[model samples]
Target: MTALRKTTTALISDAAPFAIRAERASDVAAREALLDACFGDNRHTRSCQRLRDGRAPAEGLALSAVRQGRVVGTVRLWHVSAGGIPALMLGPLAVEASSRQLGVGAALMDHALAAAKARGHRAVILLGDAPYYARFGFSAAKTGELSLPGAFERDRLLGRELCEGALDGAWGMIAPTGAPLPKTKASRARKALLVPRAA
Candidate 1:
């Protein structure tokens, strides 16, 4: 299993798991740094990035696992059309190496799924190891007919239906259906500066 898919080891009885919470805007930098450390610099070029490019995650679905007030883990889900069925795409679940054995990854998965369900999302799709995600009910059984925007391992594309039968008959290419991420004020102002002045 990859670092992101690590099995929980026997945790110290007094050592509480990292606390999970909705990610704050302040976590933006730390989260990116953690993701880079976990997935390296080239992480943005992957197939899942295509799904997330220029989009916002599903409302309230981005979570962070914090320890000692430091963000140690992160997970986010984005809205997508799972082969024509409405679904969320989960990705880039990352935990700091120092916290791997504390069950941070599993906690993030559970919390993210719960939040997604509470928000009325029907299903979630992700590319990850089957053995690791299996405990959470993710499988390829319902995603056999779905595909990503770019190269991806066929077996790694997995889905879990939050609503039973959510994925029934879902097929074809999965595509992003989330709202576009809002442009930063600096970027928007830069664009305005570039506009031609009235004659």
Candidate 2:
């Protein structure tokens, strides 16, 4: 009965054109393939893998854009903690090369975020091109006390507050819920995107 739940239900009932619900486990393979095609081999460098390590968001929060039953775009939100404060982290958003500009990515994002908010997630974070995510109300959290794991351009790390003052007093390393430090160099680089704040 919460606003988020009501909104999410409404969104689902009014699914966008050419969009369909994504099954959590059933869609992983296709989603991964779509991500590979969209991001190339360097996808891991984007910090996507690390973002969802131990706290992958529920399957209901992951969505895909389909046409003729083929996934053309996808978006995923992960459970993460910023300074131990719970939040959803959005990323690895990808749209098929052939499907760019078709509103596929936007649709997926809208669906996933509404679901997260409905589930009581107070905020979401991402390291992405600002111009693209701004339409969703994401803004630079430069003054917000949260940090990523490795070296990253500070400006690109952004957040959206689903609830007012969600990021207030939140500072510290943003980490996967229960995972250890990344082992590979690529993962290390991606982890750095979540710069840790001084304790």
User: Could you tell me which 10 consecutive residues in candidate 2 have the lowest summed lDDT?
Assistant: 189-198
Give the best candidate by TM-score: 1
Q: What is the Cα-based TM-score of model 1? A: 0.85
Cα lDDT for residue 38, candidate 1: 97
Tens-digit per-residue lDDT, 1-199, candidate 2: 6999999977974664466476444565667677767777566665546666545355467777886677777887777888877877787888887777667778778888888888888998888889998999898863256778766667777888899998887788888763343366336434543455344
Give TM-scores for every candidate, taking all chains together and pairing residue i with residue i.
0.85, 0.75
- Candidate with the greatest lDDT versus the true structure: 1
- Residue pairs with backbone atoms closer than 3 Å in model 1 (clashes): none
Clashes of each: 0, 9
Off by over 4 Å in 1: 1-17, 185-199
* Candidate 2 residue pairs in clash (backbone atoms < 3 Å): 147-194, 147-195, 148-194, 148-195, 149-192, 149-194, 149-195, 150-191, 150-192
